[model samples]
Target: MKKHQATAFLLLLLAALVCFFAGREFLTMHEEEAVYPSPHLTIKKRLSDYFPGLKNSPGDSSVYIFEGQKMGGTLLILGGTHPNEPAGFITAVLLVENLEVTQGKVIIVPRANNSGFMHSDPQEGNPQRYSLSTPGGPRWFRYGSRLTNPIHQWPDSVLYVNPAGQKLSGTESRNLNRSYPGRKHGKLTEKIAYAIMQVIDNEKADLAVDLHEAAPEYPVINAIVFHENSAELAAVTLMTLQMEGVDIRLEASPPNLRGLSHREWGDFAKTRAVLLETANTSHGRLKGRPSATLIINGKDKNYMKAAQLGLLFVPFDEDGISLKQRVSRHLASLRALVSGLHELHPDLCIQLDNLPNPIEVQKVGIGPYLTPSK
Candidate 1:
């Protein structure tokens, strides 16, 4: 009896230690990340402003607006849809700090899925934060998960039936992309999507672009996916990018692929929507040891081997896909897309200035474009 009591006490003590550590990690994940915006920002609004139901919820996020004295078309840019893709978030931050619109208006949501930034994907071994050295000081940004944080909406079902009636794995229930044209009273991710849609409708945006990155091995690497309504703009943008010596492929959004941003946002908002993707080594499955260094430097030996094996869609060698290159591609694509829109509708032109061009940013790097915090 004494032996059994002693053994039970030890098990209880071990359980308590495990709980303690787990609770600490959970709390740490809740900490909010910050970004310094440019002085040119006209107004900053919250996602809850459009969807009152999401006020003060984990899904609530910021919307930065840069309006000019001249009246013209409105364009919406989204980043951090999938937080694991650092380039998307970083490029958005870079734009928030550097962009100054002179005609029409530009609305940016740097962290579209706010909850996703609060946690890392389970068992992925990804770094929680990555830092960059700027002229002012070292700036740190959170490395977040691919989907909405489970803590905000838990107990995934065996299967997820999206609002559009598409079926996916239970895990996709947490994917914000799969919850588009969202319901006002839907789950956490859907509520976020709904708020975004509200922003588009309320602002009467002329064009919407979603930024993202994929593993080199993914076939969609270095490509632009556009809705049918945006096909002409996509073609023009692709041709312009090619003319500028930037290799980019254009893919049409499959009508059957339900619930995607390119598909649903266009359908619901009647606005042209496009999604741009870049190659990122850190986000790839064949990446080497995951670390903050890898996220910044973007070098991975395994990806190099995969490239040699012809398994990667993008070129990978000793010079891995650096964060600078990825941001350059995204900013270039944004420029091309906006230019194409101006050509298509002269009345609805969104003119932007003071944005770092791809070639310039590639040469000078993202540090100079980042405004130091006061």
Candidate 2:
């Protein structure tokens, strides 16, 4: 070969080698993260069992069941509906690892949007994974995108119309939250939603709670959005939380907002539905230094500035809102909701024996409650 041609060939080969290695690294990152549940887990299944369409699909996710010896009320918890909110996922996982149901059942879906966990949003510069140190070793969980991976479900229209007849941005079609009461033959996200509905139906759930986090600047932060059917429960929950020193606001689900879990689940299922929101600065647009530390610490200087200018919904200070605080708030609110439900319907009582209270979680941190990695 000519001198210039030989050099060009060598460069091409080197580029190809680099691309091969990079591609392998990217694919390997998609390895599924392991979640070890409490020894009390009675049953474990996949979302596909409810909607067979999701079998072997990226949307297929695990369902962890903890059934008490005696039959009673059933509670379903959804986590990672918006993968950008890490606290929701963490809280759900913590529940699975630590909770021991005594007089009822608890169902946990730690990765509600399972497909979303396979990839991160482009240009978001999000960490691919975050690690938590356990007594045995370090365990890592995927830091996923806010929406479903487009590779699993494609072709967004200009304005996507949901099964609920609500129009949203085309990109929102990939959001699991906007495709509730989903159809079995619909898109991947819709199929996932449909499967969850099936679980609620099959399990005869009494209450369903979806955990989420919003940007610190958003108005809905640190609040519970409950369906009309859950109004009495919401009121009682709010009162109990206040008595426990957790000042949480309760907002009724908007009638016009279609396809949301709080609305659709309540409308379709016999279960009362409530969605909880916590303040997450890392996901805020005003966040700086987008790193795992920012996600865990929940601290952002820009958010502090925004708070000073009265642009934030939640109180943001130099100390910042840590992950522990957000998780504690969610857990506390959930306990209050369950207590309210028990009071209203004595026959459908769910007696949870050991849940780390907010005060102790804030004082001792979440590590103590989480099961050690194996």
Candidate 3:
């Protein structure tokens, strides 16, 4: 009943209340984001189905398949390899929600790294989620980490070596991009990669595309990195994209690089592999305060200054690169790749029906193309 005792009790109660609300918000990130796929979706499977070891693990992710009436080659589109890149993730979602295949099969894994989506990277000041305005309502999606959540796979070794025997930063052990052609009994990330290789093998995918984003200052921004096996396909795609007024460049996957999708998929799975990168300010080091606005708008005064200093590879202006623009670039790149694929290999032609027109998507924004959350 003393005055100091009453004060202590009140302070403790206040702290408990704050923890309750904060903990609740943290827990909500584990809830699945509602994705409305188009009627053309023929089959939906889990990553675990391809690799039983991933069952009940955080690495398991969804796999959406769209097949045409006639048989043809299969194409695998992977996005969210690093969950922090929204454009890549959004493009995959757009295709699944709006596309129909009429000549071949398309397999999309929108969240290739499901564990990454469960949490955001630490000390980044990054927002937990971002929203897009759909005609039906506002649809929210996670803005997650680039690596697997340490909660699911912890204790980073002093050094990490991939299946291909290349050393990387210990933290990269959790990076899905660095764990390709994965191991069956390896860590969680490796298991996810192994499962993807299984899909490529079982589905007999003719081509595999990994969508990504990079900091504006990064040299590889707005680039198409192709394995040597896909050199011709990428060359044709570059011309096609350029003719469409999309500024793009091509980078050959280094022969020495190991554990990357573009490299391993071609060598191990026999699938032609390529990766597309768009510039993302929010994903950069010089970005201003990280928030949902920064993730969506991609405008940072710091980046503009950096661009003025010629520090950025991609153009950065007061206009800033909007999410819609980045998504449009990705969609156009995919469209071009598919076009080039059919051109080079008649037997592996993949046709897309109702693929969102990139120009229209840019003009009207991504909201119109995205199906409302059910």
Candidate 4:
């Protein structure tokens, strides 16, 4: 009897110890990464500023505004909509750190779905954090889930019907990208989506760009998705990118695909909406042993094999697609988009300076562009 009691006590103690360490690691996700804005940053507001319903909620996120000396048009850049896609979020971070607007306003929401950053996807062997070396020091950012944390919004419905009335799988209820023009009193993810639309509407944005990434095997990899309203602009941008030797494909947003930012933002907010996608091997099913190194360096022998088998969308080789290359693609596309927008409407031209060169960024890496942590 005494031996049984001793064994039970030992088991309990081991369990408590395990919980203690795991809990601490989990809570660290709440600590956000540091982002240093440029001299042109005019205002920093919370998403709640646009939607009062989001006040004091985990769904609330930061909005950085940079108004140029000469007022012209407003462009909104949304990143981290799917927290697992590091390239999108990192590209936004680069803009905040180094961009200088000279003719119009630029609004950036680095973490579009704040709650998504609080936890990684369950049952996926994903790293909780990844670090990058900056000029000042090493900086760490969260490696988060694609959906909102269940703690902030509980009990997914068997079928999620978005505001657009599109039926999606239950887990999609937590997907911010699928909750466009969201409800004032809906789920947390929906509320976050609603706040973004509020930002677009209230700000009277001329152009809104959402950045994202997909698995290497995804058909839409290395593509630009644009709304019908932005067809001409997209075509011009595509031509410019091709001229620069950046072989990019353009995908028009399907009118029937409801709830997507590219579709709904243009329809409801009257903004020229566009979305960019890049290849991310770490997020693919064929990936081997997900790790921070894979997220950063993006090299995998398995992916190489897949590419050789002609199963992958983007060209892949032993060199792989590093985060720097992915970020460079996004930055290059944005530059082309802005130039195209300017060409289309001269009066609404938004002149930006000190934008990182894609080739330079690819060669020097992401560290130099990132601000040093103070």
TM-score of each: 0.95, 0.96, 0.96, 0.97
Per-residue C-alpha lDDT of model 3 across residues 1-374, encoded as one tens digit per residue: 99999999999999999999999998887877888999999999999999999998989999999999987778999999999999999999999999899989999999999999999888998998999999999999999999999999988898999998899989999999999889999999999999999999999999999999999988998999999999999999999999999999999999899999999999999899999999998999998899999988888999999989999999889989999999999999999998999899888889899999999988999999998867
Q: Candidate 1: lDDT of 256?
A: 92
- Clashing pairs in model 4, backbone N/Cα/C closer than 3 A: none
Best by TM-score: 4
For 67-139, candidate 4 gives per-residue lDDT tens digits of 8889788999999999999999999999988888989989999999999999999889899999999888899
| CA lDDT, candidate 3, residue 322 | 90
Q: Which should have the higher lDDT, number 2 or number 4?
A: 4
After superposition on all C-alphas, the RMSD of every candidate to the true structure, in Å, is 1.8, 1.5, 1.9, 1.3
Clashing pairs in 1: none
Please give the clash total of every predicted structure, in order.
Answer: 0, 0, 0, 0
lDDT of each: 0.90, 0.88, 0.94, 0.94
Candidate 4, lDDT over the whole model: 0.94
lDDT of 2 by residue, 1-374 (tens): 89999999999999999999988867755687777788878889999887788999989999998888877899999999988888899999988887788888999999999888888889988888877766676777788888998888898778988879999999889999999889888988989989999999999889999999999888998899999999999999999999998877889999999989999999998689999999988888999878888887888889889999999888899989998899999999989888898899988888776777777888887777777776
lDDT of 3 at 240: 99
Encode model 1's per-residue lDDT on 1-374: one tens digit a residue: 69999999999999999999998987777776567778889999999998998998999999999998889999999999999998889889988888788899999998999999989988889988888767887778889998999889897889999888899998888898899988788889988988999999999988999999998999997999999999999999999999999999998999999888999989989999999999998898888789998887789889889888999998888988889999999999999999999998988888888888889888888877886645
The residue ranges of model 4 lying beyond 4 angstroms of the native Cα positions read 1-10
